[model samples]
Each structure stands twice: as C-alpha cells, then as structure tokens.
Target: METRYDFVIVGSGVSGGYLAGLLVKSGAKCLLLEAGKSLNPKSFPLSPMDLHTQSSWGGGVEFSRQGNLSLYRAKCLGGGSVVSQALVDRVDNEILEDWAEITEVEAFKPSNFSNYYDTVEAVLRPYEIPRDAWNRNAEIYLKGFEREEYYWKPVKRAAHDCQDSAKSSDCIVCLGGCPRDSKYNSLTRSILPAIQAGLEVQSEVEVQTFQEKQDHVEISARDKNGALTHYQTHHLVLAAGSFGTTEILLRSGLKKYLPALGTNVSCHPQFVSFGMFEEIVDAHRMAFSAVTSNDSKLRRLGVKMDSIGIDPVFVSMLLPGARKSLLKNLAHYRNLASISVSLRDESNGNLSLDRSGRLQFDKPTAPKDRHRIQQGLNLSRNFLLAAGAKSLLPKTQIFGLYLAGGCSLGTDLKTSVVSPQFKLHGSQRVSVTDASLFPSAPGTYPSLTIMATTQLAYEHLRKPV
Candidate 1:
C-alpha cells in the first residue's frame, strides 16, 4: 500500500476531481480513492436504455431511505455530475449572502466569490439551449410561461458539443448518463486531466475510517476483494457528497465529539406534474430541464418550476396508483409533457447510521415546505393549462434531487461541522470541500455552486496552517 502522499481525497466527484487536478498541477502528490469503478468516456451510453447494462467499468445507483422519502444518487467515479441532467446554475445572491452571514466568512461575499465562480464557469463551458435543440416538451413550458407573463428563461447546462444528445430521440436517458461524452462530467473532463498530470486514482475502494495524528492522517479502506489497506497522507480531504462524508465521520466516532456532524441535511424536493395535450409531444428529444421559472413570488416561497424529461421506465413508475388506468397512462406517455416543481425545503433533517452501519436519511418535508410545494404545483398546473393541455395529472410524491448541507459550515461549532474555510472543527489537516459544506440549501441548481466551493477550499488549501 502507498503509505505517503501530500494529499488523499475521498470520492472522485466534482469537488474531489477538480481539487485533484489543481493539486497535481501545483506539484503535489495526490491520490483519489473512489468507491465506484472508473468509467470509460468512449463507452458512454448510446441510448437511454443503455443505462441499465453493465459497462467495462461498473456504475450503480444508491438510495437514501427514511419513511416515504427516498433519494437516489449515483455511486460511480464521476458521482452526481455523471447521473444528473447537467443543469448548471450558480449560487443565488441570496444564498451567498446567507452563507456569508452564517459562517461569518468574507469569502462567501459575492464580490470575493466571483473569481472562483468565473474559474468554474470557464471549465464547465455552460451555455443556454440553442433554438434548434428546444424540443416540444421544453417549448410547452416556454410558451405557457410566456402566455402567463411569468418569468422564465433558458437553463444553462454544462456540456461540450451536445448536439447529438439533443437531436437523439432517446435523449431522456440523460439523467442516467450521457453516452456521447458531451456532458461535462468530472470523469472525462477533470479526473482525466489529473490522471494525465500524474495524480493516482484507486477505484472500488470504500474508506472505512480515518486515524488522525498531529502530522498525518491514516485511512483504512476495503478494496474490491474486501482486502483492507492503510494509506497515509499529510492532508485528508473528504468530498464524498453529503451523506457519504457524514457517514464516514459518524462511523469514525467524530459525531460523538462534533454533534453537528450529520445534522441539517437539506434537499431540493420536487414533484412532477404531467400535462396531456392533443398534439403529439416527444419530450425526450431536448435537453432535460431546459427552462425554469424565475418569478420573485415563487422565489420567496423557495419554489422553482422547471421542465422535466421522462422516459418510458420513469413514466411507468410515476403512473397513477389506480391499477385500472395504468395502461391508459402509459399509452398517453408520448402525448404528455411534464414539469417539475422543486422547493428549497426550510426544514432540515439528520443523517444517521442504522444498526448495520447503513446510512439513513431522516428528513421529512415540513408543513411549510409542503405548502411551498403546493404553491409550485398550482403554478405548474396553470402553466400546463396555458399550454393547451386537455388534462393535467400532478403527482404529489416528493422526491429530492440536489442534496446539500449535512456537514454544514457555520461560526457556531455546536450547530455546524466545518468552519467557513472548510476545515473540520478541532482538526487541522482535515477539511471538506463539497455540497456538505453548504450553509443551507441554495434554492436552485447547486452543481456549479458545489464546484465553486471546492475552488474556495483549494485557495485555502494552498496556505500553511
């Protein structure tokens, strides 16, 4: 086992991938330990149906369970960037101000953070949806919002030459993985650069715990064959998303000392609403989540409405509970256009390990949060009706997509896990630079914001402690 390195990062997701690249460029010996196997960019899924098939490198999904709330996330090298729709939005000014105040960190100020944001944007190369790529489903919302005089705009997405994905009839599989290598996932865009720069990566390694001393930290991980290996590094960074990082700390007994380790988890819980129109609407041929509402009224309520892409498999799952009408809903899938209304929930939850060491989510949508969801649903119905829909079916099932804030940053150690600089409380060499450091849930797409946070952490990582 490699016993010495300048830095060891857990999880090769957005933060870990980008940080590894930066560190390697600066001549640091870095090793990235990823739980999932590395995927080849050349073999990205060709069609939506290709997602379920096993590739040379394996990709899988894990679910966060509570009672009725189940959150699905990617368990792979590229993490959420691979499985997401690639909707890239920066942190809202309001969210930034909130972070600055909560953590008392000047870096969160919009002016100071602009440099990091610009750096991330340059790398991501996000762009608005082109006119030719606007499929019928996306257009439905655009036309409806225009008619209703509601604020709406084209969504910015991170991708390079996505024309093929946008033109394909089976493009709805984007949420699973982009086979064309158009989407700017970390594996192809960031981690590969780091690999070329001499950064070491070990896939299929599950880190179990960390033994931190004054000068170095030792990590114990189980490899694919269940063989445990101990690796040592001067610096340890955790970028394993919110739940994964929190679970690690909990398992390592950090939660006993820092009670805030697994609390204040927030998610953008969304409900999907379907509108059936007489005209045939092939929603899958466009970029998923092509446009969203920007109305101030909705923003105050922490609600955002965006167009959604649904393939046959997902559509079948969301079919009405009535068994008799299941086939009827399936038959109209082609003619139905869908929109998702997601709310930035105010009520935060907690993450805890079950008796078997499995991570469990205990966040329930608060009544106030549910009210905002209803507000979003009502607005969605109005927009769908404006699009000349013959009928509307709004599913009230709440599902969370963008997860954040399990190990949040704050000035108060009693309520937060990390400091404003992304350093874990009571530790010098340990830091976190992921969505888990978000002070609270930002009320929009958080992919870009999460990346930007790592940029901030990178700046601090260069300074001597």
Candidate 2:
C-alpha cells in the first residue's frame, strides 16, 4: 500500500522548497522530490570544474539544437540557489504590469506582490554589499560606469556574514557552493525548515511521469540506482523548473489536452565581454558581483549590464582566441575584468521531446533580441574602453542562466498551461508554481520575484475552490 501525501512537490528548488515549507507548516503531509543528490556545505564542490560537472544538468554545457546558445540548469538538491551568487532583485514594475495584462492576473502587479516580496525579504534578509568591500574587478566596473556616466548601483544579495575581505577570494568559491553557509539557499532557508516541519524529502529521484486520476495523482520515477519507484499524492505540484516541468508533462502525453504545455519559453540570453587591463584586477576575488547598471534607457530597452566574476575554466570558453593565443590570453586571467549583458528577449521558443523521448529545444535569438544584445555590447565596449582597458576580448558564444516560461499562466486554456489560480488547466489534482508559470521574460534577475510569486501561488492553493 502506498502512503498518499496531501502534496507531492517535485524539484526541491526555490519554488518547491518554499512551497513545501508553507504547506507543511499548515499541517499538510508533503513529499518533496529532487532529481539531484543532497549535499551539505562540507560536501560542496571545491573547484569550478567540479562544480559545473557535479551540480548542474548536462555537466553545465548543453547547447541548443540550433547551436545558437548554451543552456545551463542546476540539478542539485537546492537547484540554482545552491550554485548561484544569491543575487536577489525584483522585476521592474513595467515588467510586472505587462505580466498582469498578459495573464489577466492582477496579483502580478507591484501593489499585490509587494507584501510577498516583504515576506521573502524578511526570511532571506538580503542586503547590499558595501562599496568599500568591492573587489578590483568591481572597481573597474565602477570606473567604467563613472567614465561613461551611466547610472549604476550596488547589487543586493541574500548573503550574511560573508566575511568578505580585501584579500579573501572566498566569494568566488560560492559559485560552486558556499562552504561557510553564509549564503541563503533553499537547503538552508526552506528545505531544511520544511523537513523539521515534517516534510519528507526524496533526493536523487528523477521523476519520469505523472497521471492525474479522479482523486489522486500517480507518479513514476527512477532512483539513482535505476530502480523504479511509485508515489501517490492528493495534490501534485510541478515545480521542476521550466525545462524539467515541461519535459515531464510532454512525456506524460498531457500535451494532447494542453497545447501550450511546452510553448512560450524565454531565456534571458547572456553575453560576457572581457577587458584586459594593465593592472591586475583579480575580479574573481572578493565579491564576484557588486554593482549593476541602473540606466533607465537600458532598462526600457530590455537590457541589463552587470560586473561578473568568471572562473578560469569558464573564462577559457569565453575567450575569443584559440590554441596558443587562447593560452596566452588565459595567462593574464588576473588582469581581465568581466561584464555580462543580459537581454529580456521578445522572441519566444518552444520545448519538445525527440524520438528517443529525450528533451530537446529550439530557442533562437530573435532579430529583435539580437538587436538588443548588440546595443548592449556596443555600450559595454565603450565602458571597457573608457575604463583604460588595453584590449577587449568579446566572445560571441551566448548562454542563458535564467530560464523561464514553458508552462505559462493565463486565463485561457487555449494559450496557457496553468490557470491564474495556479492550477493546471484541465487537471484537478495538479498545480504549477515555478518559473514555468512565467508568461514572458521578466527582464530582471528573477530569483526574488520567483520566490514572491510562489508565495502568491501558495495563498491560492490554501483556499478551497
């Protein structure tokens, strides 16, 4: 006999972990499933190479079918929260307004989401890094912004007691995992608390498919050792991220009922530009990201620029030269300053499974999105030049860290997978509350907004229809 849980939440990332905590605190029996293994601070990867290979899906280097961009998604117990820098920024009001109009969900507006943001902030306690603690790489970014006369501001991160010092490069290791436990992640902030509240967790279980019955939902998954496992749930929450959630639904043949199951996917394509300076920048030391572009025009154009610290392995991939030239450029790693430009793409793509039941996607950078990237690149080049960079190494390889949409939220079943009420359209026992619910690109760092939106979805779930 299978013990049926009140809620079986898949993917113990930001959405799943937070939702599990809330549901369990409300006295609901919940089971949280994660595709990756649970790792503690001591077990976190020690090097960038190990981090990318172990903590991310496809070894952090899967490219699109069109070969236009590389896709990186976290596949660990805490999902992206474990590997990210913990930068938390809310979506702009303009983006939220567009979402409200597109989904016809008034709760997406700033006024409604403010309280949820407050709730998340109270828990995460995000704070801005002090200017004095800025690293040499950050100093270069500040110089460029000041020389270019572009608006910039300190970035807010969900970190505490980072113990960041002028000589400390501890922050760089955080890209793999924060060993000091200073960074707020799902494992520390949500999943562990939910466990204390009686939430059951199953890590290293790759969910394959689910079927919604009249009364309960049946789930089929495979454990790490290749044994099939079954689970029953009164309510199913698909928080397996955009790609994971869409793949599961497509594999389950649910697309016959929901045409938009894997449509309207948007990834904020990011391009990194490196500037070689005469002085040693050591950008990877101290805080990796300390400031972001606050230019109003750039925001209106759906472009964002931020200082970035890249490990040597990733920097080699981004460097333009090859062979001897690449090695020569890499030798000056300490003198390279980096900045990333991310565009809120207007063009949308879709996800589908191949003949072998493998997940594949076609996400081409649309002409408009290309234009935006180019515009951002032009500005970034100027910033680097104005900051006294001797040479610039701009790579054309595009990648996306922030993945959203696929199972969008709206009022109509013809175009949306999830209803505004957070329930899957045409399914009684299933719901979705993750980045999969994004109707379009939010044009911002979405970590803060993702958590806030999950809070809103939780409110709807707690109420009876």
Candidate 3:
C-alpha cells in the first residue's frame, strides 16, 4: 500500500465501497480499510445455523427486545451487504423531508434524492422478483394478501438474474453470500470495480483513531497481528455503519467535542409470525420476502410486514419446544409460512463504551413502541387466520436489519456529529458517509437509501477539497 492517498475510507461496506468506486472513477487515489477478513464467496455458508463467527460479531447479530432488536451487521470486507438479503427500497418523500429539515440541507429534498436514486439504480440494476419464481411459501403470502384486500408491492432486489436461483432453493443462501453470484452486494459490484480502478483495500485492519492535520489526516489502525500502523490521507471517510463508526469516534475522544457522537442510535425493532398450513409450504425454497405490505393499518402503527422464509435449523430455534416438540416442528418445517413485522419506533437508544472499551448499547423499547409492536402482531395474527392458517405462532422480538443514527447529521453540532456535507461538524478533513449520519431509523429497508446517501456525499466530496 502507498504511504499517502487522496482519500482513505475506514469501512468497506456499501457506503465505503460505493464511494470508493466513485472516487476511483474520478481518478482519485483511494484506500479502503476493513475491520473483518476478506470473504471467499465460493465457501459462503449455505445453512442458517452455519455461524461464520469470525466474519461477524456474535454471528453478526444482536437480540435486544427493549433495545436493538435482532440486529445483524456484518463485520466483513463488504460489510452488511455481504450478508444482507439485498432488499432495495427508495426513501419515501416524507422521510426525506424530515431528513432535510433536520440536516438543514437541500440535498435531502425529494427531487435531489430522486436523481441519486436513478444513478444508484442504474449502477445496481435492482429488479423485482418475477411471479413465476415465487416459492410455494411466498405464493401463499401473495394469495393471502390479495384475499385480505391488503395493499402489497413486489420487493425489488439488487441482483442481475435471480430467476433461475429463485426457482431453486439457492436463494436461501443469501445470508452469508450469494452462491449463484446473482445478488449485487458491494463485494462483487462496487469494491471489486474500485479495486480494478486502482483503489487499494486493506482487510482485517481495524481503525482505532484519526487525527486531522493541516495537510492530511492521520489514521491509526491495528492489523490482525496486533501491530499498529499509521497512514495519512488528504480526506478520511467513515462508513463503518452506526456501531462501528460511533465506537471509533468515541474511542478517539471526539465524543468530548461532539456531544452527540453516540447518542440516539435507532434500530427498527422487528418480530416474526408463523402461519401453519395444512399443505406443504417448504419455506426454504426462498428464504426471503418477495413482497411487503402497504396496508393502512400498518401505516398507522408505523409498521411493515413481509413474507419470510427460514431453514430447518433456524426454525428449530424459533419453535417452542423441548426435544420432542422441536423435532416435531423440524419435521413439519415445509408446512409453515411466515411474516415478519418491522416497526418504525419512536424510541431511540444510546451507544457507549464499557469500562473495558467494549461498546455497550442502551435502547429501551418504550411502552408506545411495545404497543405498536403488539398492534402489528395482532394484525398479523388476524391476517394469518384469514389466510386459512390452522395455527399461528408469534415469534420473539428482534432488531430489524436496518440500523441508523449514532453519528447523526444536523445543523447543530450540540445535537449531531456531521454536517450537511457529511463532514464532521468541527473538522475539515474528516467525514462520515454511513448510516451513522442518519438522523433517525428509517421505516423501510436501508441498503438502497444508504447507497443513495453515499452517492450524494461523493458528488460533494468530488469537488476540490
């Protein structure tokens, strides 16, 4: 690796990868440092119980009912994109308006985000799942929603050609990595292009701190060997997700300068409900939602529900039973259909470091949030009943896949960490371009929205700096 570069990105996730690709396209020298090891897609895990623990923190998940729910954030080179379902959704106009008002930035306006969405979509080539490829389990949802007269929309995913994989059970391996290379995660779509365009990437190099200088920013990191190395760059981008980015800033003592460094972290809480049917459903055929809800009742509760599929191993854990009951559920896994509920909670959490420098989360799910969750659960139960389900099981609470806030962006430095340009409020050479900059948790899937935000940040950073 070179001793100096124009830009040094701290995380190799969607934001970092996408921004690095754009910078390399503009002929800027970029270096991307990832905290996790590089992945060999060929060996990606195929079973839900297969814990690639080294590539993730607690299997890249956290289960907190009163705080962050079943939160899953991959710590690998490509970050969450490497493990996510790649569900792509644009930010709604109302959400953008809220962001614009909070950040006091015109770029958050609906029109501006539209242009970024177009560009990102063109690059990612997100497509909707075809009707024919719907598994027996997902098909039940389509018919059930239609029968209930609830508004539903097909899910758009970041993939090239998924019909073949969608037809088989291959799509079930989406959590670890795409076995057929059909999904468009940052590893395959963005970072690889950046690498080919001369962007240097250092894997398993965990950034500890950063210092801004007159001419360049100094970055300190530790490799897998525990040896510390320092690097310099004219610009520093933090795309290490909410938890990672916030932890780095706190560890660097920026929390003293930015009081809101690790405050107001939001993880949209979620739950799952299983609808047991008489006939075989075989949910493993497609272990993700092919459609999401647009029901008025759900909107009132700030909730979203979608079809869900799980493997036998995970189902065994979800099933309520001792050994015999667990075995019974496993045998009938194919006869179960599922729906997942995500709530846009008003309650927010805080991120802090324990005495040992380990990150600690305190997000108490407020009573209102719990009420909303219960409302969503009841509605889902009613829907399943109407769908001819013989039995229903409401799963435990977990954090949604999307997480935001922590290092929020706003006009007030007292309440936020970054500015409209994504630059640290009091720093010139440092900026955060990840979910850490979001003012709140989004109600929908956040991968596409994060990419769009990065695209906007790239445009602002590409100019002379």
Tell me the whole-model lDDT of each prediction, alpha carbons only. Answer: 0.80, 0.87, 0.81
Model 2 Cα shift for residue 159 (angstroms) = 0.8
lDDT of 1: 0.80
TM-score of 3: 0.95
How many clashes in each structure?
2, 0, 5
In model 1, where is the ten-residue run with the lowest total lDDT? Answer: 52-61
lDDT tens digits, residues 57-165, model 1? 2232234464445465556778778877888887688779888998888888999888889999998989997767777888899888989888987888898787734
Better of 1 and 2 by TM-score: 2
- lDDT by residue for model 3 over 341-381, one digit each (tens)? 88887888888888998887887778999889888888777
Instruction: After the best TM-score superposition of candidate 1, give how far the Cα of residue 397 lies from its true spot, in angstroms.
Output: 2.9
| Tens-digit per-residue lDDT, 337-402, candidate 2 | 989999988889889999999988888778898888888888898888899999988565889888
Give the candidate order by descending lDDT. 2, 3, 1
Pairs clashing within candidate 3: 66-365, 69-398, 69-399, 70-398, 70-399
lDDT of 1 at 226: 99
Order candidates by TM-score, high to low: 2, 3, 1
TM-score of 1: 0.94
